[model samples]
Target chain A: MDRRTPVDDRTGRRIVPETARRADRPPTRYGSRPTMKDVAARAGVGLKTVSRVVNGEPGVTPDTERRVQEAIEALGFRRNDSARVLRKGRTASIGLILEDLADPFYGPLSRAVEEVARAHGALLINGSSAEDPEREQELALALCARRVDGLVVIPAGDDHRYLEPEIKAGVATVFVDRPAGHIDADVVLSDNFGGARDGVAHLIAHGHRRIGFIGDMPRIHTAAERLRGYRAAMEDAGIPVEDSWMSLGATDPERVRRAAEAMLSGPAPVTAVFSANNRVTVTVIRVLAEQPRRIALVGFDDIELADLLQPGVTVVAQDAAALGRTAAERLFRRLDGALVAPERIELPTRLITRGSGELPPAG
Target chain B: MDRRTPVDDRTGRRIVPETARRADRPPTRYGSRPTMKDVAARAGVGLKTVSRVVNGEPGVTPDTERRVQEAIEALGFRRNDSARVLRKGRTASIGLILEDLADPFYGPLSRAVEEVARAHGALLINGSSAEDPEREQELALALCARRVDGLVVIPAGDDHRYLEPEIKAGVATVFVDRPAGHIDADVVLSDNFGGARDGVAHLIAHGHRRIGFIGDMPRIHTAAERLRGYRAAMEDAGIPVEDSWMSLGATDPERVRRAAEAMLSGPAPVTAVFSANNRVTVTVIRVLAEQPRRIALVGFDDIELADLLQPGVTVVAQDAAALGRTAAERLFRRLDGALVAPERIELPTRLITRGSGELPPAG
Candidate 1:
């Protein structure tokens, strides 16, 4: 089945389920306004003339323009921008799909995208997928229906073949933070594997023999890559991997607290912990605070005020805004007539050490 | 001049300034894709029937819909939701205007707005005003031209009378974080005055006779309210506030640092400080850390990892998400046919004492 089928197809419109449910509702009381056609008729001008005057396109003479303008003001016509945007092609808008807009990591990322879109004179429409595949698909298709000029997606789904149809239908697509699944597309990413590896190595280099890893669900690409990085660092140190040292699941504070506590429970507790993301790192800091002993830490993703904590949080800092900037710039590049095969672009991460990563293995 | 003018008045069309600049440029290779009319022609159906099938609107026989769907697929016709939404009235989209999306405070707040919009089956188009009135007005008007169902604005400009035309034209608008100047409208705000008063009083109760106040530009409503609160607290405690005890300007770190250092450099420095915002508070924290004496601080807005710091930061916290959620819910309530007069809403603030707010007057 075509992915761009009727909006409410089999699954119903995830976008407007209520509208689909109450399809017969009358237009809102305030919605009975005039359209461009009304302005055209009122001004005794052609439809195209009304469109031109409303869009500010330069073609009409001064006197004719004034008459159209007068009619527009008299009738309260709004140019039907959606219709104008349709007839003209190119919406001058882009859509950004992400896991959560509220997450600190994505906030800068979203801002970066907006900055780039502004530079290109385009507006941005975004929605959170909440890390669900179905939601991702639903939101993505909704934007497609809106006919955005392009799309920047932070993937949640394992398979994105559903997007193939939209991509073919003239929508520019770029994936960031994580690569698209089961599809070849332009992707901008932080070197998750390398970043995690470096964070783990920093702990091991501090003379911590036993170390723990806390991360998100293994199904997530970044989490899985971080786990691999941890193993690689341990293997390089000739330390045997311990299943008990790894806990991967949700990044909620409670879950992370439990994971960190469990890892510190055994007689062979880890002397240090490598947190795979900012949320996990934050929770781990609280968990360690309650413990009597100091647990060394090296976390992925630097956070605000990380440098002011007791030991200061040592982190592998990935530039989220840079990722977004790079992806959006590349998208505009594609829109500007650069035809090339889709490729993956990975930006490097920096290790910022104030003190936490430098701590020796605790007694 | 008409607000929607800039397009060719009688000439017939516009909206692509860059395109108009290079009016001679070729169509994008992907720009020749078939439109809804093309699909209609192939499906041998009326334009309305094609729209009905595309939007999943009722009254379409299955046979006609199937033929339309086939034509859409065969011709790769992606529905122009912008146009369809115009004909139907109600675009199922809202606009959000704010200071900066990258700011941690707004990240969650914006998310709350998006969540509410999603539940109502609408998309959110947002732009950062960068604290510029002109930029805010520009962004707001652009979204109006796009014909969003409603707008949630955190005003960067004091006067919002410019939006009167749009609001009168049927856009449901709600002011957030800051009230609209010169316009009567629905406003949802944190108890800026009471919160600041209580926070300053907390410092005075700890025997701090001379307390400094650091805040954003005084022209901002919240900042002015906070200063008022600070003065009220001082008057209530019978302590006189000195000129050196107040600094109001940009919240940039360097300026804030200079202000803090300048205040502390006096012969008789403030024994405590009431930071009026998170940005100001974070900067003051660094400055105080460098000084030899202990400086009690009570801040508005909580930061990430506040509790993890050596002396946990004390704060009078206003729920940013609640501010957003309340504004959004109220916006939807207006859209849902509630005919109520515009009113002001104030959500309460809570003071949380950690270690920083309890410091004694020190030399």
Candidate 2:
């Protein structure tokens, strides 16, 4: 028997734990909600007859159908969709695993996926991985266990061998914002490298060779890609990037603050800054605002009220909604039995020149 | 009969639709996954014997267990959790319905609910109602049909009597950001009225007799309460309010822009503006920035990088995460069998004075 939980430790109440709730009490299904078995008993008919009537299948006489319907109303017997789903073989639900729901960047992406799922007549269930690999796997598998028909993942880990079994078992999955490691799967991504390179190059074009780069941890695929872009932009300009100008680590306010401060204080400080992502850019904006001289800055992602700021923030904008919509559309296509090999779809990014990016280096 | 879908219209290929996938193949449980009967046949045992081993019940011999395990591995059969959930009274999942997922204000709130749900080992599935009553009802009922253990609702509709049957059937629910209509359900809210009154009063203290109130539609509870607070503040100061000074409707940029423009233009224009929410605040900031004379502004909800602006935004800040965490905790407590009456919990909002709200009236 499953580990029987007779009471909740926190409340010390006799509560039926999730695992044992229905297993312990087999008489009534779903806590006093009458089952088809109950409907059959009340209707004085066989279980099959009740099932047929409930499912609206033929061969149930009018009198039998009336009896079943009456029993259903009397007993408040709403057909358990769990049983219906079990019989149907599909849950009509899809799972979305994202980095963090609280991140404004992901909010649009998640919503886009949900809209697509809704259009396809599938409910979307999502979880935030908090950018942890183990948590990502746990959440993904749990969603799979619930038997969601498909998955849209923003992978935290490089290795996804754990999903192999589930994939083989016919769970269609698509990765977004990042690609899956050690797995051949459909991936939807923004042109992170190109976008970042263009953003950095734009700053360089504005007469700044010593431009600082503040980015997320290099382990993250987007971070690594963006960092590469920053280097390539400098290399193309014949400006050898100095070690002090590159800060690649955590995007927390404290760390980014220290990084910005350290870079600005050196004997030869960077005159401009390339913020790799939104979180990093917000902190950098705060740091730059207190400075005696304005520092030219460019951010990778667009933020709300960016245009309304004193010097509007310039950004290499990627469409988060487009990324999500593409991935979900592809997932549905796969589910529609389109026999196509896994492929990567990269969406283009645009650079919007707001006042900040156009500012010349302050002496 | 459940609609027999022989082919997918989009792909023009044979497909197993959500409803009939398992009903068409009773021998198989989930899309070619082996059933207990398959295992029993391979292990030379009865169906009940196979089930006993699978469910970890007593009286299964070690030899039989080994044989069943081998058959399971041979067929690559994983137990269908949909069926497991059917046998288990609880699905171990909760549903969250919010106004919009892409809104910055809701991101932290949703994350908070997810965190609490995680603590209780329940996965949260949420949908954006887009503030539409019909959509809210559809999503809530669908979640109910899926048998989610509880629901955390940020109600979009005034009438939630539709949830009566589901709530009575033992689906624990808690309303957040708003209250349930016609039903006395547990609700967690920010002190909208008191916060708004204090915000408007702050402008009054700063020597602005002509204050303007821009808010959401009065039909919304928070919006109406905030408007009431604005009126009370003006009345306390013995200043007769003009009809033209108030704009209460949609918070979209276009509408908010028009509203802000209208309020600032007329004879005896208001010297200060009180923005009701985050979205409204953002739009108003833009309008105020473009003005030749600085307009004192107080907004509700602290926004990102608010302090970095030329005149940092002063806001009546509500803790969104606290609201969500509190509501989720109550939901889990109800699930834990807390036999308490549905109560309203009000969290206090804070007044953060940066620079904008402190500005004196322009000459």
Candidate 3:
């Protein structure tokens, strides 16, 4: 009754029925080999017991389960579920599509999604769209074709009508950090407008009338929202925003550096500056550091070592991790049979004044 | 004969298929359902021809390909490979298991692996082990159950014999940043020992004999190697090592601060400190800034804005992105029919000497 005793002369390799069948039989079903069920019937076991052991679910006694498991191990049994859909119909996997994986902003967001997915006993399949619309569509459609149970998207493209069919087919979708255009979906976002408004208002509160705004391209949703916040803050203070005071362009270091310099060294040099995002913030900080250290600065999005700097740059901090976590949670909830219409979840941002925001307007 | 004409009722609401199956007997697989054969039949071609069109493969005639594509789109024929895979043996996906996704080191690594996976037209499934051995095994086995084509592991545990079966089943694996124990596998590593020795020797050459080494836990491979390098450098310099001069513990900022304080304020204060990693280095820099500006410092792992500080921090810089890219490239090469035994690849690290490393020993 020694189960592991070798039955073959092939170097202690057990002579399992399925292994023999695989060697003797030609490939069947479009060149796909037989699955675990084929092996299970050949070895003789209840389907539920085989499934329980395969999924590592508890219930069966060790001895019987061990035999079943050994039979599975010997046959090289892989569960082929295309022919059998479980009652739950859950794949225990999610998809994350973001702007760029290499970008520091999206890195934490992707990690956050993975963390939540792991906690829920799910796997994450991710891709970067590189901000290309066609690529975005391709990547998204590819994930859909793979039948990922849910999706958490940091959308690069505004329109997502391509996702309509997949969404209808029960693939729960949640947008993170940005909304999907031309589609209604659950979206989790940071308070970008409020963050930007507070950042600008902080500089104005520090006695700066001529405050400059440095932001990303105007077409970006977050960028547009931040610009609107800047305008709202200025309007609330009864200060008309001058056309020359706002600089909207690419967030590349060189461009941002020039923008910061342009506003700082202009006819009426702005006493304070509001940077829209972390990249723009870092670039502007470098530019400010090159100056006489008299101009005040407040940046949106908290960065690492922000408190360790010379003046300790102040910032309006949004929880990037929370944005990702909330979106993923909603996505899973939808997958778990929540059929409610789409809703927006906005997380608040906090202004942390750490010396730089407290600086007086340069005279 | 035009399919564009909608047979709408007087209510003006368009009628759509409500279930996957119906009584229409529309010659579909299950009423309005489209299968590969259906597409092929409609296009007057073989089943594989429609598969080629669905998979975006070249070689289909424009006229017939358009007809097949139209049939696919009109019927919303989303490919269900998950079901088809019950017959097919291989899943075109790979798994990436790493320490923590949130860490700056692994973010780029994950992205690099993702790029390689995408280039090979494969999807990537990833999980973070969070430095837990059990979790690592759990995640690894989960991916195996899903039958991924291969794995790229940043191993959290030394022993990986549990992965022997998966590897034997032809799941190609490559370890990055660390070597796998109890398993002979391909590995990509930075030259930790040499880098640490050079960093310490640089501090010693700047006229410092009493150099403190603040490193991560001794159990970690890199930390242990770096500590050995520190001892070797001290021995080569004919400097007797004092037990208090080295502190090996967790890399958390609080523990690092205490370690730095022990070296700085003790009876026999070290003239210089060699920090073993970026987190420890940053903490030590903060601690040094509190004291008199006399202590020299050399840190392992270059960080952003290292040169921006008053006395620029010196570091042994390892190209993290390069490590990732090389490892991923090797992995995909193996997947592309390169059947070779596992080999180890070591990337070199360089020590950059700024003002901090050149400071004279404190009086």
Candidate 4:
């Protein structure tokens, strides 16, 4: 059964829209588009004449062609290029399904993908999954319906079995930043585990036995991997960990602020912090700024103006644009049949230190 | 003639790949999409059976449908939804043409537009003009060829008469961030003049007689408008401005650093600087950080983490997301048959004071 969602208002309330799209989207129909017939009617020409004008085929008189062109212009008629392309066998465009466009991290990544696509003389269609599994499926399927030549997906859902059908049908796919769930396709990932381990280890190296870790929800693979890295770092140092030192959930400022405050005032207060990602790092920076103690810190992901702040933020940085570029290149390779097997490639991370990670632990 | 770009290689050089999008893009044959006929051939099923399976029509047994589906999957056949949509008058999609998706300022704005589109059960197709007028025209026309229901444009071109045909053909458009040039359309803009005037006036009131202004290229309407505001503020205070105090050009870091250095070391060294935009402001901040003397600054457009700095940055803040939301809402209203003449809507900007704007003139 085809599924439809209730429209959301500005306040997040569900409301029925006055029919922007139909609910019974049969395989035979999707949305409306102005066709050659509309142009013919507006131009006072026959269907064949309009088609001739659209196709640039000879035989139609110049005057009649002009009239059809005017009608096409006036009616905003768009020739069904998708239908014609069906016979040709390639859509010179690709789909990019990312987690969210609003996130600063993804903006460069998306732009890099767009640049690569442009250089390849192809257009790009982008959709944000908004971190919803259903939304991801709906968007990916919608792009398939448009018949994009290839797809670059940053998977929001663990199970991408639904995409198997499309992939088998010649949709070259490459997963970026994260792995596709249950799929054996080309995947490009940063060394999240190694980067997190090094960042936490940097904090541990600065004479800090007690360290706090703030991360995203455990459900996210990256977040879980980062947590595992923290565990490994602590184990390597033979330092006992505390329950109060670990906090995992959304990257919302309020939650992160509370987490930082709790760890600072906990039974065994942490002397240092290892922020797992950019969002968490930003909030921790704010929290540490307001507190009196000097908390040594190391964060994953580089941020704008990181060097300007007092005690410039130390970070384990991953190249977002590079990740996108590599994945896109691989996606094109698959389309060109240059690649033989589904490969997993992991890029390295770099740790930058200025003031925070090198700070001495406060008594 | 239909235009096509050759694909680019990783070395930042252009090279034709083994095969990609065809060089020729006849209006009639944009790109090819897989068809159901190919699927039928692959499955060894009759065309009628394939049709029945695709449409989910009854009478085709489950076994036969499975075979047809397998063929469909293997063939990468995407049901031609655009062809079906031809009978309808709306595509339930909108196109957004912005400067660059990689820019931090546009991320929230694009997200807001997408939110509005989603609220109306519409999808968004975005194209970056990359600040090139020709590219802007190409991207806009391409979106029109796809028959998007509406358009939200952040125009890079000074002349947009090319869009007249599309607008006349019932493709509703709303210009955001910048006014449409050589064309009449609904435009939503921030009060650039008022905001700049206020920002510069704040610096003047802080006991500064000589203040510097660094802005973007004069060709951009916002840059020129902000410059005018700066001049007006200086004239209103009866403070004659020196030509050496004003630097206008690209907002790249090296140029801005040079401009700041020149202004600070000029014969009549400025006591303060009023930066025209976020990019300039960020660069100026970095330059000022290295100098021994403190130079007070008030910038247009707020920066993230502005408050957490040693001295919070005061800015004349314009709501980017609000501009996008308003423009998208107005575009949908036009689609809903709002029969009104094009009107210009200007949203107000707020002056935020934290520390920088309130600084005393340094000795």
RMSD of candidates 1 onward, in order: 11.4, 9.2, 10.7, 10.2
Query: What are the fnat scores of the candidates, in the order listed?
Result: 0.53, 0.45, 0.27, 0.27
The CAPRI-style docking tier of model 3 reads incorrect
Candidate 2 clashing pairs, residues 3+ apart or interchain: A22-B89, A88-B22
Best by TM-score: 1
Candidate 4 residue-wise lDDT, A1-363, digit = tens: 001434233432222222232344223222344677788888888898888888789898889989988887665576665555545657677899998888999999988998888888777888888889899999898887767789999989999888876776678898888887876777887878878888888888889999999999898888998888899889899998888899999999999999999999856689999999999999999999988988999998998999889889999998899989988998888888787568777777889997999998888
Give the Cα lDDT of each candidate.
0.86, 0.87, 0.79, 0.83
Question: Of the candidates shown, which would achieve the greatest lDDT relative to the real structure?
Answer: 2
| Model 2 per-residue lDDT tens digits across residues B108-194 | 999999999999999999999999999999999889889999999999999987876677789999999987897767888887887
lDDT tens digits by residue: candidate 3, A1-363: 124533434322222221121243333332233456765675577777787887789998888687887787766565643444323456788999988776777767888898888888889998888877788889888887777888998888889888876776678898888878877778887778878888888888878889999998887889999999999899989999898789999889999998888888856889888889988988888888889747788988887777778788899998878788878887877866764568776677889988888899877
lDDT of 4 at B191: 77
DockQ winner, 2 or 3: 2
TM accuracy, model 3: 0.87
> What's the true lDDT of residue B170 in model 1?
76
lDDT of 1 by residue, B125-191 (tens): 9999999999999999889889898999999999998876677667899999998988767888887
lDDT of 1 by residue, A1-363 (tens): 113323334422211111121344334455466777888898899988987887789999999999999998876565557876767778999999999988999989999999999999999999999999999999999999898989999999989988876776678999998988876678887878878888888888889989999999999999999899899889989999899999999999899999999999878899999999999988999998888888899999998898888888899999999899989998999888694567676777889998989999878
Model 3: residue A250 alpha-carbon error in angstroms: 1.6
Per-residue alpha-carbon lDDT of model 3 for B228-261, expressed as tens digits? 9899899889999998999998999999998888
Please give the clash total of every predicted structure, in order: 12, 2, 2, 7
Question: Would you list the clashing residue pairs of candidate 3?
Answer: A32-B87, A82-B83
